[model samples]
Target: MYLTAVASLRAGHADDVFLLKRPGWVRDTLKQLDEAKRLSGGELFVARWMSGVVRAQVPGLFGERAAAMQDLVWCLAHADKAPNLGWMREVYFHLAALHRQRGEDAAARRYQTLSGFASETRPATFTTPFSEAPVAGHTFSSRLIREVVPGAVYLLSGFEFTEYYFVVSADRRELIAIDAGTRADAARAAHEALRARVPSLPPLTTVLVTHAHWDHVGGQRYFRSLSPSPRFIGRGNYKDELAHDAMANPAGLQLFFGKEFQLADVLSYKPDVTVDRPTELIIRGTRFELLPTRGGETDDACR
Candidate 1:
């Protein structure tokens, strides 16, 4: 029964139709999950939690809002039994959004606080790029941009897998970008979105890479296409780091990055400028101090 329920859920996800257009799929999945929970003698906590989540999303499709609220509250009541703090955080975040949608500002704020608490309490080991679940507050198909330093620095998030930033030079005539994205298309889309948002954004003059990870450098080719091109800067050990990763199992890399990932793009990435030691660069009147560090993910990391 549990295996059947899992299969049902996967099929529901595979459907291309919007949830609202497929209420039968949602209802069927919920029924399967409930049966799985019962057959497991209530030992299937993950199934139960997933049922609650499915129920919560039903209001957005074809159900009563009150029913959705009840299921969300039930999920919170069972939060202590969650597989991980990350899952609990997701519940809180979802509840917050639901409350806000219903114009319950106070309840939304309370759940937002709880969500932040869950995030802070979550162990670092729970954080991984390979989670099948989507990141909270981030939609892979959308881009979110925020001005981190009023008019000077901005952050671009919600790329397929990573976030990058833009810093306007002191003269506001050039932009220094921090990191590319996971793919050339993603980078292009993000850049176009950023340009649309900040119509006056300057031309990219420099790109500072923090690491040589595939996700960070896969979009280098897009930046290189700019007229005159931005100067790409990265750690001098970039080649050696890529060489080391090349020895890793191909299946393992595909599992983490998805089958759509291209090894050749990552392998062909090369920065125009490399730094091995402490160095400082001044681009368009903005001073950037680069420091090397042994990052948790890779040795070729800079800040």
Candidate 2:
């Protein structure tokens, strides 16, 4: 019956995507679908995945916000028809994306773990290595800090979560780094790289964080380890963001796998410089204007 209904719908439309806000659509239709139809077919699975994602992702895209995921949940309840999305990794990625849209990183990572991948790691490879895996198409290295702008802007792909940035003065006498990644390793590597390639490149006087998310500030402590200990700067809401993280930090370990340490050892960052309102500063001939943003990915995204 599922295929029959989909076929009827597809007969008129050239496209495959359909957006039905009603959860009853899938439940009622699937309930009447011919039992002989194979639910495991890839096309059907894609249709179901779209249905699940739309429902699971939106907070109030529909008039009813609370029951958004109800249809998707119903589909998941069908033990047999449901796709092997659990360990297959594909559906797991979509579910993770939906959860992230809901601002539930922990919840997303929980689903991600069942698929044998944890974002807390490098590229979130499987924890339980079920099948002989091939070389990952994607690899991440945080320590390699490369200059995006000659003698000026630099970026360090710090970790799976955090990426750091550096801005140097025209004279190469003063510099500021931004957003240290998730741990001390990235910080140490970034400093070592800078020291090796451009030993004469300015002293890091300030380090600015774009937001208060753990991935943005987790490795902040290690910035103090750099020469002269650059001051950490964040928006005025920085304290509130930190307070929020401090409350949620404990649960983070359970959400995403903690790399190389126990949950109790995980630490959140504290900012040194706070800019309230739009503020402009001229330090060592470099002008910086700090502005706060309400939300892009987090509640405290700043510019």
Candidate 3:
């Protein structure tokens, strides 16, 4: 099962893995393993293997980066099970890349070599084009620019992810919530702050997710559950990638948000609004033009 799961992940059939899990495979497996433990003298490693098989197929389906990352770490940390060396190598190489981006050359090199992802196979070694900092904790509105367009445009820079864009109509009634802070706590805090600043503004009619990483989408669940729930939007391809990452890793809770948060914590909120192609929407009178972009951080992004 573990090997099958790995093949599915590499083959890009992550959705199937989640379908099996939604029915409660993990809980069922745990029960069976508990019975096995009672009958046998020792805890069996087979249970671990079975779980990894299902997990390795799509680690990121948990819909959060911290969750995806922790799962990747768990897979690598487990030595006793009949592990998937390739999956371990891929995750380690990815971690090495993350470390190099953060300027941890020593740690980067360590992971690269340990995973057998040598410098020769790829382009330059230790080249992380993205920011290394743990994504900035704060954000502010960019200078307002009066353009030919119908609505006002605001730039959001110095963020943990790429810059953010928030557009509001000339009339204060219509409003749309753009990117929130990265990490669940940061995102949640930012949303609350935005609310406190503008007390009379209408409820958020729409939320546009630029991409589907934790930093970008962490507050999405929180925002979606508001009283007059806002319509959430994302590139159409967004869900599959997010889902794949969650199932394969299932470690996002630990790696990104810290270990206290877990899968059960995130399932409470899933994306209610998803869009495949670049689209536009008018929320409470404010209009937004969402353009899709692809780059170093995610396969699909909204600009």
Candidate 4:
């Protein structure tokens, strides 16, 4: 019965993974798990473990649906079951944000205080291509552009010194892009550079987004609309980050870019493959292990 309940929740397709995050489903699932736990008697450990997993994941799995899903009572009931304070940090932050959004200053402050880290201590500035420092340990100058060996990959530079890569396959039959430039001009420059130098390159087959920051994803739509549109690969919370940064109704674009911000270009695209933790990828026989970071440039970033 426990296995049956778990199997029912498995994602059968890309859409199911992101679409089935409603609170009603969670409530129903929890009820079923609790029943299974009761029925299992002495062998209830598996059901108990699964229940704990759902409790911890429910906060994030619902992402932008926080207003309806962030039930403090539910969390308090399972406080003892929480893995650790560090694991609960994001949950605390989200609760704080939700309270703050609703004008409950006292409640907001309470949740913020509960968060393990001081929010103000984080740097407001990020080291981008515009910074004198190297990006991911690769340096570039006004005249120098970034390049990777063997297959001859090109990294175009622009906005916050935004750098996007154009990866050519080992057999030159496919192109794999990484991030689009910050804006139209930057994307145009990258596109033009590709046309002028790598004209023979084939259609893009895949795009791996390092994070959901504006500088990294601004040009994604431009690339996605192109012929032979590529499938996106990113972390599971990638959509939530997109919602937070660009599309979360009021607090997203309105707060950052202002009310004048155009909603047309901003999109919350689903990743074809979502990684919950460090995972390996093989692109055209090339193996790459994606590792999660404590967030170097942004909280959603992976190294």
Candidate 5:
């Protein structure tokens, strides 16, 4: 029911005054989220966070600033309990915007700084091993490398916008990279950094991409240049998805990837192996089950 309301709200453009002004839609949506919270076993933090976001949005369109500020403040007080850095950052950014709307410059600046700090520290705090995870809202501005599963799996965070992972085979003879990252330079630097940090790590023999998104496959060319070029793997619909994105938003490519991003690089990336259905792959001794699934972000996704 909560998901249904969210979908409806999204379809109706929840921010539009027409939907917010509808007799009981917004109010009932909040009520449903409240019920969802009650039945969430104290684990669904997103429900509470969504409610706060809706309340924050109501003020500008409906002139309910006082009530919205109260809910936003409550969310701020409990921001530490947010499920991830992205959620925590949104709460801070919302508060900053609300304070700015109310003419509270100092308060707005404080939350803005907190939001930037959250963005800077996100890669490290969430990707590190569970036992060694950093405190919430910790501030740092450098890349981080951590062993997620001791000797078998490791994480390379903070090199680029997306996090990359390296997995070792059971016999420790082969290494596989999870994603290529956003740019060749960034990917090359991350790969070199990992090898430098773990000199005994095995040669990278395979590169598996979760999807055909620009950020995930941009570094394919670099990986292809290795001594024994690693075999690339991606979803069967990879090319179709890339073509769709290229036709739909060709102009926006450089906005996120910078002016230097080349569309030809992304369009030319091809996986040596493509999985359209459930497939089992054994790299050296480590086994991986590849499942292609559709998601809100992209239909050509593999897990």
Candidate 6:
């Protein structure tokens, strides 16, 4: 499909190219085109595309024709039909024109001779290698640190679940925590630790959720009881979204239910914090760049 798309684009099929959305839709087509190239008497669409670019390569290949001639002859000879040969001839002509422009008539003549020889030669089969062996799995460990890079901090509460949070500044010298702790104690401890480090302990700020998952958004209510109580950052119709997701995905709902129960059992609070959308606060001096991406692991994912 990629070759087909490339061909279409080269042939001025802009609308077709636009509709295909290269990365998403054209991958399958490109694979098909590759398969066709492998078959003895299949489509030469990709070759046609290559021929256009190849033909246009002559001026650039002025002193390099002798080196490129073999590949050119191969492209011309190793295709199954007349149109393919015709495409090769068109490419040859373009290269010839380029050679003429560069005053290399002898080199042009040499390419013309090779093109004629291509008519006498036949298409040869091509093959690629494949591996069927399974690969081995690997594992690695990550370290825990408190407030390593300002907004980004690693809070470890004895390995059950080590969480990281990106702190966003809140109104009236308060802060909002993004991706709070796994348990209530972890969340409150993290808040206190951050406060102690910053010397602004009381009047704790809000807590936000990256997604509805237990691990990422586990400390929701714990931090929500601050003086200005933290608010959960979610979509416009978050409740509806959450309900739809829970119903549609039973396994996902089960995962959240267990975490929610655990969080509720161990919940602790500081002060009250209000919640609202468009929470445009600087996170520990690092500004978050929001980019839309496919979200499966978290409610919101940054690509």
Which has the greatest lDDT?
Answer: 1
Task: Name the lDDT value of residue 39 in candidate 3.
Answer: 48
- Residue-level lDDT tens digits of model 5 in 151-267: 888888766556779999999999999978766766787899989988998999999999988888877778988999999999988977788657746446555554445566677
Per-prediction TM-score: 0.54, 0.48, 0.41, 0.45, 0.53, 0.35
lDDT by residue (tens digit), candidate 3, 1-303: 343334334334433557655435443433443344344332333333333333333335433233334444555566433222333555666667656756789988988898776572554333222333223423232212222233444443433333444455557665566654344544454445544544554556666777666556655555655778777677667655566446645453344444333343333334556555567766646556777777767866777
Tens-place lDDT per residue, model 1, 183-293, is 677678788888998899999989999988878887778888889799989998899788975676755655655555566777787888998899989877889999998
lDDT values, one for every candidate? 0.72, 0.55, 0.50, 0.56, 0.71, 0.43
Please provide, for model 6 over 226-264, each residue's C-alpha lDDT reduced to its tens digit, 9 standing for 90 to 100.
656555544333333344334444333324333323533
lDDT of 5: 0.71
Where in model 2 is the C-alpha error above 4 Å? 1-143, 158-160, 247-268
TM-score, candidate 2, is: 0.48
Candidate 1: Cα lDDT at 188:
82
Q: How close is candidate 6 to the true structure, as a TM-score?
A: 0.35
Give all candidate RMSDs, comma-separated.
Answer: 15.1, 16.2, 21.9, 20.1, 11.4, 18.9
What lDDT tens digits, residue by residue, belong to model 4 across residues 138-198? Answer: 2232323456664468765532245678777777777777765444444555776666666
**What's the best-to-worst order under TM-score?**
1, 5, 2, 4, 3, 6
lDDT string for model 2 (1-303, tens) is 355556334332423335552444444433333221345453354454444443443335344323334434444555244333332354455556556667998978876675465563336433231221121111143135577987788876523344567888766688887776555654666666876788777788887888876666766666777678888787766667666666664444334423421222224455687776787877667787888778667666668
lDDT of 4 at 167: 79
Show pairs that collide, candidate 1. Answer: none
Candidate 3: lDDT over CA atoms? 0.50
